[model samples]
Target: MSTVGKRGASSPRELTRIKDRLSFIYLERCVVHREDNAITATDADGITHIPSATIGTLLLGPGTKVTHQAMSVLGETGAGVIWVGERGVRFYAGGRGLTRSSALVEAQAMAWANRRTRLKVARDMYRMRFPGDDPSGRTRQELLSMEGRRLKECYRRESARTGVPWRRREYSPDDFTAGDAPNQAITAAAQCMYGIAHSVVAALGCSPGLGFIHSGHERSFVLDIADLYKTDVAIPVAFDTVAESEIDVATRTRRNLRDRINSTRLLDRCVNDIKELLDHTEDDDLNDQVLLETDGDIRLDSGRNYGDELSW
Candidate 1:
């Protein structure tokens, strides 16, 4: 059995139910304003009520207009808000997230900022994408090359499986019209994955630039996480979209991706995967900078006692 959430009832179960029902809320060419604890959108069609609390994410696509009040409410309620471009819902910018802890963020940063530890975490990431396989003795580069080869073979298999023409990965952000059907579908699928991935990363309070396998960009972490499911999620969706030969690849890709993400429980999986990669036990704390959250603040986890506070 499932439950539906009202305006003020967005418990964990209710939120999961919402994702099960409406994967995400896509807003475009509308003015969004606050309505009580919810939000309303007015467009050429009509007014519609949005239970922001129940939503997993609010993607602000092209032509979307949001008022300050609405933004404030969404932030306060901890909704994932993403600003996307017209081309395949490219994630351009983002707003506040729903993460309740800075401890996770600190842990991620410490893991990524270190050298030896970063390699360990990166190996764990590759291991996550390919479970039941032993890559324990292999280095990061070897694992990367292996994953690349697997992906190349996957594309070939999918091309034959779906009968969609597959040449190579071609993309140009400035010109989306230049790409062919498969290319367009690929971009559409990747962007959709990125949007969803961005929400999960943000919701975990993880920095999008601090990446294990990627570096030197603001969205490095986002790309790194999104790539983990590219072969399984985006590749299949893109190929299927191309096989359908849909005139609107983005729309069809979004539809398929929503269903896939929901079915896979990608949001929750992303959170757990991140923690698994960076998580350490009592024996292996990094840099002596271990941290924890107590009542919403990040503090050193070292078991040291500072005597009772005295007047300074």
Candidate 2:
């Protein structure tokens, strides 16, 4: 249910869905200027002219075009599909029926997990810094303990808000298959966590696979964040979706589930919560302060907020 833009040797323009023109996806190098009558794309020596009527979703690679008629055709069909790639517009007509509920659930769980993981990391850091000093260690320990308590309280609140019962049992590390009665809310929670972990890894400049609290393995950072999001964003969204859709475990499919998860408002709320938490938090002292604290001579754009740009 997500479109991923691959980073290649030849840098292509990032793809974006057009606002105020939901059917239209604009392609630009620096800024949007032109609209196409028809787009011709040649990849691997094969030329393809994407007709407007046939395309449900457009995926544009760098430097591509299509006609206005095509845009009009896309608008006529209310099929929600993603336009991906740089400027060369490809189409993903399938998977429109994919559900997002599971994704949302996963994202929420991840967020909660991450919150816990970060606190654990901070606690470990505090202990490492003051092993024998009981006074400072005790104070920090109390604070860490409070953070954990708050996180649990938040988890309960979020679960109540979502109307989904929290799964207290630990998932087996070996299990990967979807279970009967899939927890769509947890899936969404996990996705959110993955996003947050990526953000933290980027900000902290650490190998995402290497972690302080989460194990050092594939997608360990993602695991960490999934733990965090459960209490903060996922639960609320799950509750809202359930109320709005009036659907229960018996009727929810992957497609409707995806719809619930991809609800723009829900995503925004989740992002906002994560951003708010991060904005208020001070950088950990043990983090590479030399890299994070250095004020360099390198010129950079001043108006941009790094948090605002993070999306997966």
Candidate 3:
């Protein structure tokens, strides 16, 4: 039996070809095995096939057993593989690089390496956050302070809107169980956003660690990208989840966030946002400056940009 039915002769001939793209996926207490280009997920409810090419991120939560073959299929489709703890706590992730062109990555590195350009990028980031505002000559510290004040106000407003108790954002890296309901929900939602952000960054050929606003972390760029949507997406979802008197706040928040992500088409927005910030244009071309070798080392093409359309 085929996982997907064909519509006509011109329809996708390969089962691995995903017809519809999903924003994200979260699975727990299931077994995932690869059959051709699809992943068969089995649990108490029975088995269902997931097309690897269609998913933005596959969150392998607790009790999810996956085979090496499934991973191979997922990688070949340029999807993301994320491992999370029970209840949607992200542990780590891997993703297929969205583009072979190093144009975006090179631009990002160049901007981050220069102080003047980095500050300009930071200003652009702030401008992105406040679309109508002018960030000219705004110091980095001023931006940080402004961001903090805006966040507190955002949390207060959301809590008021959702009738959830307002409190400070708190989470400990060593202990996930220490926060209150809203706090835990926020953490879970943040993790989900991080997973999606990681996939976007990877797909765009951007460095996840090269962050302008934040630095010194493995997922610095992921954090930066995710931060742009946190106030509107994750924070609102967390507050609403807590206000609903749910038994599992984290789970509910994840669901709500996923819904919001889909409804808002967040992954698409993320890709566009990254490209805009990098100043990518229709005439732009990425050089084959970075090529992944069999040994996983990236090599340059004698310092020439690759002449190809940006696929991501």
213-236 per-residue lDDT for model 3 (tens digits): 889998898899999898878888
CA deviation > 4 Å runs, candidate 2? 1-9, 12-148, 162-184, 191-206, 242-312
Ranking by lDDT: 3, 1, 2
69-183 in candidate 1: lDDT tens per residue? 7886677566778888885446778887665446667788899879988888878877877775677878878987888888888889999999887887788988876888888
Model 2 C-alpha lDDT per residue in residues 1-312, reported as the tens digit of each score = 111123121111121111111222223332211124234444455555544322223333345444443333333322122333321112222112111112222333444357564554545443333344332334445755755765566546765765655654232223322322224434433433343334333222333453434565654644544454444344455445544553443123323433443454433343333333333233231221112221353333445556655333
Residue-level lDDT for 147 in candidate 1? 89
Give the Å shift of residue 46 in candidate 1. 1.3
Q: What are the root-mean-square deviations of the candidates from the true structure over C-alphas?
A: 6.6, 15.7, 7.1
How many times do residue backbones clash in model 2?
74
User: How many steric overlaps are in each model, in order?
Assistant: 0, 74, 4
Per-model TM-score on C-alpha atoms: 0.82, 0.34, 0.83
**Candidate 1, lDDT over the whole model:** 0.74
Best TM-score among the predictions, by candidate number: 3
Residue 15 lDDT in candidate 3 = 23
Model 1 lowest lDDT segment of ten: 280-289
Model 3 root-mean-square deviation: 7.1
